[model samples]
Target: MSAAGPLPLVGRRVLVTGIANEASLALPIAQVLRASGAELVCAGLGPTPYHGALSTAAEQYLGGAREAFESTVREHLGADVPELIADVTLDPSLEDLAETLRLRDLQLDGIVHAVAMDRTIRGGAAKPLLQVTREEFLDCMSASAYSLLALVRVLLRAHVLREGASIVALSYLGAERVMSHPYRNIGVAKAALERLVRELAAELGPTFGMRVNAVRFSPWSRSKAGGAIPGLEEAVAHAASRAPLGNADPASLGCEVVHLLRPGLGVTGEVRHVDGGYHVHG
Candidate 1:
């Protein structure tokens, strides 16, 4: 008998970021990636030196978030799966991450950019877009959109990201359309993120054989970030009813991501909708 071929992701090292908790979309994607024979390094949001001074409440919140991230990774991914603290909003933090990976001699094959935040949407309500302040707007853009470019740039400069690396960013339908829910500020950020995917793909593909793509997931309300978005529950229900395949679950989304992350694929600069054909509706 002939020898069997290796698994699609075997020997590939993939970094999955933005795993806030068990319900996070990144969790399932990481799970699928690992199952497909990829080595995983996970990063989550936490306090970084760039923050300077933090109040007691801020400290507590950050500490708690980090602890939860560690616990979740331990429980689901495994205790030995490497975990790193990263605040994508900070360039210093991103540089630190790149340095850490370089020092570890880890050359990444893929990156899952699953980070996003919107201060304009809080306490189960979204501030009117016109009412959003400059700081708030910029913060949203920095964390949700520009972080991809920043992270990739740092990795490329540090030589931590190998040529032909696959980069996937999570997006949503709100990027191009006005959702029934209040997607206001984050929607704009997602739109920018999608644009970054295309622009990066164009630049990176020919120059270094890298691929960049974004996936617009279904109206998910199980994650902490998703549940916090006002009217998302209604949006989820409405989407489930209207979508041809109901609602695409995290597992399906994971599979598609793994497909994109697979090396040697000709696909790039694509914004794929994993929302069960809901995006096709007018």
Candidate 2:
């Protein structure tokens, strides 16, 4: 232990997923985890063999996303940090990631699930729930909700996630309530994500000794996804005004996540609010 005392996550390895760019919430979370002395392995969405025959536009978009993710990771997290491309919506892509980790003999102590996507949200506007199609709904659900279960299942099957590992998923208050902004399809997916956290926590805790939890953060508009939601800026302003402690920043959220990720917390299946008392209002 140094003068500052022993790091809480010293010698632990964590997998941080869904880093789309430098403004991503996962970036701050990963920074906090590393500051606590954890070794990090990062995964970002990119084209995979499973995608199979993407249109030129789709390929270009994916390529740009991957490039941004790579640049952000290299600049902020360090070039040596292991980077893996994964499209959690694809089972084979997830399996490939697990295989790579397994081959490297890495056992993760924690996982940060920061991935969420909604095709129904476009051009800073969200389609009404009634307007959402089955395909759009399922696509949102698969990426934002089911991906958590899929990732954990693949990692567990590969024996890459160690016993007692902690898993934290990023969520929002919209999961449980209608927000001033249109959450629509993503809200439903978030609800499922939170439910999965509880169910997985109960099963994994008793059977595998793993912990699963989620953090609902403030109405942030800095990230790409957050900025794309119509009326989110207004929501952010309203939340800041109403919240007792104003609003929680990314650093605060990061700290909360790292606290949950710490070993032997005896906490699981919790939908924690890191939104500065915003979730308590009527």
Candidate 3:
């Protein structure tokens, strides 16, 4: 509705996950996608009710993250839209996802996988991954890396996504190199996630005609997840100095993901860096 007709993503059914607030990368992507004419279905791990109903466990599981999550969804997509309870850590049931999509009566055109976590068992706190415990390493990998595979597998099984569906996940430069404060096993997990994206491009491209990729983002404006990091502000300032654009902004990355999700692009199975070219210079 920007006076240029419906956005390119208009009429597309896109599902996005891992949104915690209005500033979250996923929400920005959803906002842009919706503006461009894409219908959206937001999935989150929060315990918000669906259509005025919630399981006892869900109410407890959402813990303290529910209110913010609900408010965020309302801000981005408005109230009264479908928001599903989904945990990327668990293998999502295709039937459940399909049933939810059926309720919306929208064909899946793209998926955004933004789920991630670190139990801090890494013990390194913000230290490098080499110092982390095996449990910490695997836990991060399961939450950040393997979840992409699970999501795509479930969607593929359910035949929910249409051909040319784009799958995107978020990553960071630390996944390939070392940072001063260290982020435990997150770097290794990101590397693994990128690898999986490439492998999935090969495995699913021909079979399902879908594309898989990840965006490597630098530190950005603060969020609850980023605030948990010990020296995030310093990291952002450092990246800004080295970055071509002199800053890392989530909005830019959100726009980039929307571009990848749209049709008429040949990019597939690649890790697109939207970090102000910081990855290249640094």
Per-residue lDDT of candidate 2, residues 2-71 (tens digit): 3668888998899999899988999999998898889999999888889999999999999898899988
CA deviation > 4 Å runs, candidate 1: 1-6
TM-score of each: 0.97, 0.98, 0.87
lDDT values, one for every candidate: 0.94, 0.94, 0.76
Q: Which stretches of candidate 3 lie over 4 Å from their true place?
A: 1-6, 47-61, 92-95, 121-124, 127-131
* Residue 35 accuracy (lDDT) in model 3: 70
lDDT of 3 by residue, 137-221 (tens): 7888888899888877777666677988988888887778877655657777888999999999999889878888889887864
Q: Taking the tens digit of each residue's C-alpha lDDT, what string does model 1 give over 185-212?
A: 9999999999999999999999999999
Candidate number achieving the greatest TM-score relative to the actual structure: 2
Model 1 weakest lDDT span, ten residues long = 1-10
